[model samples]
Target: MLIQPVADLLSRNADHYLIPADIVANVQTDNNLYHAFLVLTKIKYSKIPVLDHAGHFEGLISLPLITEQMLGFDQLNVEVLMEKRVSDVMETQVKTVPNVDDVESTLHLMIDNPFVPVVDNDGLFQGIVTRREYMKSFNFLTHEIGKQYDMIEKDFSTSEKSK
Candidate 1:
């Protein structure tokens, strides 16, 4: 695992879910639940990025936020009804693990966040690590180990049978 590439660890698993960096659905602070829902339905993610007038990460609009507001409103407007940007709702206090970290360390850090952003030494987002991915890799490793033991057992049994 020490010498293994992140790509190898990633490749052992078949499922890879990713969100595009730029295609985030967003709404102005003034938008309402109607607008939010419209955008959400179009985007692949329930978690939407919120941008300010200047086009920066302002907060995030989530299902919960829409639900909360829609519960009370018959009609909604963009300015009054729109939720904050992702910066507001996103886990701004991000916990990161280095790409070079061993699987064990990565597992430990993953205990908190389902997805941990992988970063290089310069702090650029290389990729993300998910508990599901780790579990898949672990499962593959265990399965391989089990197969080895089973082969050994079968070989011993064959030898004994001959004796």
Candidate 2:
């Protein structure tokens, strides 16, 4: 099949690529680092979404960043460090794509961000599309494409043998 058909299928399904907020844990700005760390460790998520008390998307936080903060202080200061708010450590330079944006574009953004936060036209927090989930979808497509290629090869061999 032509590449256009594949592109069309992927672009057309863009609306459904987002992983709804209900399924993921979003951290609050006022949440303590200790709590945030616990959540990240428990979920094993690649990235965590940071939101305000009103549910607005702020930025994305990773375990490594938080770990770095913890390492900045000595063991005696660990307690004080954990008491710091997530907003203090989370990356404020987060890149967000509008919810209306196509999945193809979102996939590109996911190349750098493990979790791409989805926002509404007004920039309210909607959900995220995780790299892990995206990879799963891409992997499935790769398997299907391999199967198609094998079928075509088998067909070509049979036709040549008959000729």
Candidate 3:
């Protein structure tokens, strides 16, 4: 109920929120843009993680990033999509939360990203913590806390009236 307590409660381990790397759809750095685009389209996700053959977190590739390569001055350059590697177009500056992170930091990162990738100290891909999953946990905590406070308030009022 208090600010400190709420903040502490929200500081849950990032691992608890993880959508493990194994289940997450991703593309390797060597993958061509054409294949990456198809994967994104098939999953209906705007973007997805990029990894190395060793499973290290490389960056992220989006539909727009692939589409940009397809655009040309006069006509669509379909060849670029087939030629360029995902590493050539993937956004390497993506923000990633460490595996040791807490939900509090991940929550901040999720403000701009749909999901924040988690990586180990070795930069190995761990998983992602999605905003949707965080929201579900937040919703449950708020409602349960609200109900507890309401019961306390009701008890307080009853005692006041009797006095």
Candidate 4:
């Protein structure tokens, strides 16, 4: 129940919650908007990471970003979808964290993102830490802390009665 111990608990164990890079769906920088859209649709994710040929993290692509570019005069422009690259419409200012970062940092980033992309020192895409996963872990920790606090209170009451 102590603030510092709880804070330390929250700061540890981010690595255990990661969804590894092999399972994360991503689009390449050179992929056309149409292809990126298809990937997002199939994955059912609003956004995903964009990687370069060498698998370095570049940016993030979302269905909305792709659709906005495809809209023209009240109709969808197929040409723009086919010709414009994902890089042209992707959000390059996305928040990213190194894999070594603690869950606290990851949690902070998740306030504005559904998932925080993890990268290596060289910016190679490592994986993602989703808000859903982090919240689940946090919920479990809260329950554990509550149980411990209850036991401590019981012990204190017994000692007081003995005194």
Candidate 5:
């Protein structure tokens, strides 16, 4: 049976883009150096995307990077630590999937990179899909398939009655 593509299951809701208001204030090039530490701390537990002023995709910052810096450095000052902008720290070369791609292709892409960014033809950030989200899509697909079968069966019965 044909299955809906992964793009169909992506959380198109705007809420997904809402970062935890309290977690880490969005980083700015002029923001404090220590802010990066806070942002890194937040990423330790969550996989969040970083964006630049132009709203272009930036590389993901994780807890490990933060921890490494903390360990290697003598002082944790913003200028010393936060010298890198999200643009500098982020993975400049990002792997993105098109909105129209099929679920199988999306899943494969996710497998290749657990944190895959979804982008439009113009490379605008649509949303991000983690491994967990991909699995959730699979489960959602299972239910949809069952629902389709029930509808088909109902239609078949109705046709028989009409005859």
Candidate 6:
């Protein structure tokens, strides 16, 4: 009942790979810009995923976006940033994938996004399948293919020597 040829694609490894909550800087929709800045700086993430109080995936907030907006103002201070909401500067047009969906689609989506927000059926926040995880899967599969090819070559050579 095993399907070896396409087994790698059907593997549940990436689907089950869950990201811990502590890794993401979940900037809330109502979170003040100053607070967002503090968290982003501490984590050193170029961009961050935004979540609502109900734990729904909103979009993303980037340091570049904040800096671009802040540069327009004369008095650039923490208080000035505190006056704004992360929602005000966030890019709502983000790429996201459903947790139940196939992880391959997510992998392809990651080409444009370094981080794809994992969402539930109701569009709630789950975790993430980062580039690191994706790359690991790719490397493992590549190694597997090479291993299979070597085995087949060795079998062919053994049979030919008997002739």
What C-alpha RMSD separates each model from the true structure? 8.2, 5.9, 5.8, 5.8, 9.0, 6.4
List where candidate 5 sits over 4 angstroms from the true fold.
1-33, 42-46, 73-79, 112-114, 143-163
lDDT of 1 by residue, 37-139 (tens): 6787777556455545655443456666665544535754455345543333333445555553445566677786565555556544445556776777776
Error of 5 at 60 (Å): 1.8
lDDT of each: 0.53, 0.74, 0.84, 0.83, 0.52, 0.75
Which residue pairs clash in candidate 6?
A: none
Q: Give every collision pair in model 2.
A: none
State candidate 4's TM-score.
0.84
Clashes of 1: 13
**Tens-digit lDDT string for candidate 3 (72-111):** 9999999998889999999999888886346567777889
* Model 4 CA deviation exceeding 4 Å by range: 11-13, 149-163
Candidate 4 lDDT over residue span 1-163, tens digit each = 3366566555565567789988999999999998998999998999999999999999999988988887898787878889999989899998788873565677678888888999988999989988888787688777776764543544578788898
Better of 1 and 4 by lDDT: 4
- Indicate the residue-level lDDT of 129 in model 5: 52
**3 versus 4: better TM-score goes to:** 4
Candidate 5 local lDDT, 115-162, one digit each (tens): 566666765566665666556656776567565444343458878889
Which ten contiguous residues of candidate 1 have the minimum total lDDT? 14-23
Question: For candidate 5, what is the lDDT?
Answer: 0.52
- Ranked by lDDT from best down, the candidates are 3, 4, 6, 2, 1, 5
Q: What TM-score does each of the candidates earn?
A: 0.47, 0.74, 0.84, 0.84, 0.57, 0.78
Alpha-carbon shift of residue 133 in model 3 (angstroms):
0.3
**Root mean square deviation (Cα) for candidate 4:** 5.8
Give candidate 2's TM-score: 0.74
lDDT of 2 at 30: 87
Poorest stretch of ten by lDDT in candidate 6: 1-10
Mark the regions of model 3 whose C-alpha exceeds 4 Å error after superposition.
11-16, 147-163
lDDT of 5 at 146: 61
Count clashing pairs, candidate 5: 5
